[model samples]
Target: MELSEMQALARRVRSKYAAMETARYGREWTDEEIMLGFLGDVGDLAKLVQGKAGVRPRDDLDEALAHELADCLWCVFTLADSYGVDLEAAFTSTMAELDGILAAEDTTT
Candidate 1:
């Protein structure tokens, strides 16, 4: 699926979670709080990445790494949607800029 499709799916999932949070805790999580949750997921993803790279030992490391990556993606998609970011365009532009920077550095060197 495309990034846009994934974004829509993430929004629906986020809405469901927000409703559940409101029902259970009487309030939905703020955007900042959601970002913090994303940070935690990032931390977990880092550990799983390390394990998958054989820098650390872990059982079911591959599966765990995949799950963590998806978790990180979900958080990013949700956060981007909340902030009105066009993530697909942003990603494309950012990568192109980075590529140009690297190309320039290579030419200079």
Candidate 2:
């Protein structure tokens, strides 16, 4: 799916989770709380990456890594939408800047 589609799906899932959180914890997660949850997902992804590197053995390593990566993406999409960021545009701009820097470095070398 395209990035926009992925982002839309992520937002929908985030809304569902927010509803569940509200029912379970008296209110939905604040932005900071959501970010903290994302951080936890990142930690999980880091371990999964180790497994992928064969440093940390895991059952179903590939599947676990894919899920963790998706979880991280979901958090990023949700956070970006919540904060009014045009993530696609920002990503494009950032990549261009990095590529430009790399090209300049290559010329110097």
Q: Which candidate is the best by TM-score?
A: 2
lDDT of 1 by residue, 29-88 (tens): 999999999899999988887876788878789888888888889999998888899998
| Pairs in clash, predicted candidate 1 | none
lDDT of each: 0.90, 0.92
- TM-score of decoy 1: 0.91
Q: What TM-score would you give candidate 2 relative to the actual structure?
A: 0.94
lDDT of 1: 0.90
Candidate 2: clashing pairs of residues: none
Q: What does candidate 2's lDDT look like per residue over 1-109, in tens digits?
A: 9999999999889889989998999899999998999999999999888888888888899999999998888989999999999999999999999999899889556
